[model samples]
Target: MSAAILFDGPKDAPFTLVLAHGAGAPMDSPFMAAVAQGLGARGRRVARFEFPYMVERRASGRKKPPDRQPVLLECWRAIVAELGGGSGLVIGGKSMGGRMASLVADECGVRGLVCLGYPFHPPGKPEKLRTAHLETLRTPALIVQGERDSFGGRADVEGYALSPAIRFTWMTDGDHGFRPRKASGLTEADNLAAAIEAVDAFLAACGG
Candidate 1:
């Protein structure tokens, strides 16, 4: 797609994290920026890139739908190739980005996978699940999700037959973006920090 990658942290870091944006946000959205910068400050190299559609939107100044699934998957494969076939790399991102990463993690043979706020299913449409692949995923992965995310809340996800290799860090009263409500007495920033901490720990566990 001819998209340029934006990098963070030390150039000589042993392991690198490559992250992509969700369906609706660009790579540099506030959430993405915060996560990349947080990890970078902690001595983790992070890379961010946009999909073909997002790149088009940037050039045309118009919002567009995400590229088709095959296109997105190919883009991810290309990224992994560009980064030297994913050795010593963790691949993941916000939502769709993370989901896509999960699909390719095993194929790429990446060291680990991380999903910031996974979209378990479409909001308010629990029947339209998107987790068939997750049930048998072999790659070790971590998914940070909110307890009450409409996409896939704790009640729903706990019942799914996900792989034992997949672990979770559940946030209190979080939404799709990991933002907690006012009455919950938890700020979005709080959840974000927690997510970052969880990711750092997970990366360490993965030998990054």
Candidate 2:
């Protein structure tokens, strides 16, 4: 069985958003919690789960590298199955977790995808883009990214080809996790609220 942590919101809500954590944080990290709670407050049911590495960290109190691609993918699939096969569900996450979800979304046939901050490429290595799969994805997707995210900022992603099914929502002067700089006049809370609204709308459009 895959190890996971779930955050349950309104049980009778029309839809559920299954969220995963980023590369370095647990499922209940401040960012994930904020997003989950924000969505829940808007009357959307949200479920958050941790990857295996994060679960290990919780048990042993030691940091570890993320699991390999196959392991991550398998974990997502297993989680989906355990969560009742994605009916009325939108699946996604932050950064690396979001990327993994995008890869398997079509196969899982979820209602839609909502990526809080997609890692289009590795930090400082634009040549190694992780967007080939995304370019041809058929699943409906909403990618909320920081305008200045090092993984793939607005300037960087504008040149790349992405699928028509994917919609991009840029957060002003924000970084990997959508935290904006003070000079930009945008607060992290404001950006996060915008992201939650965008997600709520996207899921609504998908008939969730």
Candidate 3:
């Protein structure tokens, strides 16, 4: 079964991009909303949904940690199945959400994967890498990461043996949330816009 989805853009759009929230936020977070709305405005259908834990938190008015990896991956699978088996779908999300999507992108046979601020590892714990599967991922992927993301800064991530199928678009001096440093003379909105543009181009390349 698929989680309830909040959708944007025309139903007849060529491809449906399904996005999940990060570990802490809901699907309607400011960041999620901006990206969804931005893509919607560009003529791509966008769908946003929450994981089971986040859904429960929404109903109970309480904070909750993210679900375990198995549960999160199951949710991605169900979402893809419910959306008609992912032939024309692009699956992705913010941070942990994106990571979960990446884990299942190939399994689901999605047309493409777009990871916004992918967590290469926990913040300040770079030794615990979470990219073994990524080394051989077959599905085309775009990882929009911050140049200085604490989870996996460019300097750190550049050395990883990720698959050639995976491409990256880096945000200037940005952190996990893609918010650049003020002194860097770049704004969060600027990075976000760039990210959106990259995703748009990626979708086009995927024949969306």
Please report how far candidate 3 places residue 156 from its true position, in Å. Answer: 0.6
lDDT of each: 0.92, 0.89, 0.93
- Model 1 ranges with Cα > 4 A deviation: none
Worst 10 residues of 3 by lDDT: 1-10
lDDT tens digits, residue span 101-199, model 1: 999999999999999889989999999999999999988899999999988999999999999999999998998888899999999999989999999
Q: Output the better candidate (1/2) by TM-score.
A: 1
Could you list the CA RMSD of all candidates, in the order they appear?
0.9, 1.1, 0.9
Q: Once superposed on the true structure, which residue ranges of model 3 sit more than 4 Å away at CA?
A: none
Ranked by TM-score from best down, the candidates are 3, 1, 2
lDDT of 2 by residue, 1-208 (tens): 4575576668888878899899998888889999999888888889988888888999999999999999999999998888889776789999888889999999999999989889888899999999889889999999999999999999999899999999999998999989999988889998999888998898789885
Q: In candidate 1, which residue pairs get closer than 3 Å at backbone N, Cα or C atoms, i.e. clash?
A: none
Candidate 3: residue 159 Cα off by (Å): 0.9
Judged by lDDT against the true structure, how good is candidate 1? Answer: 0.92
Most accurate candidate by lDDT: 3
lDDT of 2 at 12: 89
Per-residue error for 189 in candidate 3, Å, reads 0.8
